[model samples]
Target: MSVDLETVRRVAHLARIKVGDDEAVRLQDELNAILGFVEQLNEVDVDGVAPMTAAVDASLRRRVDEVTDGGNPERVLANAPAADDGFFVVPKVVE
Candidate 1:
């Protein structure tokens, strides 16, 4: 598909972008060139090629899942503006 000046104007309006006549014409040419490149890409054959996220093989390191109370509450609350009973205190917002 190709883009015309009118199509460029409509796209700009849809995207809430303000494009004057000169800018619209430039955008039209650019969009047409991009679509032409996509058309060329469609001619390539990739019947057996596998989709990949990256060019290199990669894997994530795994860790065992464990749960326990945070060992140090006093250290965690050290920077609180107001703390009580090992918890950060905040002004109540609801009655």
Candidate 2:
């Protein structure tokens, strides 16, 4: 649960980030603070509470699903650099 400088360095390497020695030390401090906050959160009681998506209660609005031809293939393909037989043309890489 505790983050050290070596762990922070490993995290930076995994994320493809370039962290200097000073930045790594700063990140180690920040990670320790975040872990401390999480530890504080673990002490709270929430036995009977239901999980909620939002504070207010309201049903999410939805639209009916229907299928139709988007109706303009020629218009859609008009800007293509290279198109053939109603499809975008790309160079074949595989034999």
| Candidate 1 Cα deviation (angstroms), residue 81 | 31
State the lDDT of candidate 2 residue by residue for 46-74, as single tens digits. Answer: 89988888888888888778865587889
Predicted model with the maximum TM-score: 2
Q: Could you give me the TM-score of model 1 versus the true structure? A: 0.45
Full-model lDDT for every candidate: 0.88, 0.90
RMSD value for candidate 1: 10.1
lDDT for model 2 comes to: 0.90
Per-model TM-score, in order, reads: 0.45, 0.49
Evaluated at residue 77, the lDDT of candidate 1 is: 96
RMSD of each: 10.1, 6.7
**Candidate 1 structure quality by residue, lDDT tens digits, 1-95:** 99878889998999999999899988899999889988987777988988778777778777778765578989999999999998899999789
Give residue 55's error in model 2 in angstroms: 3.3
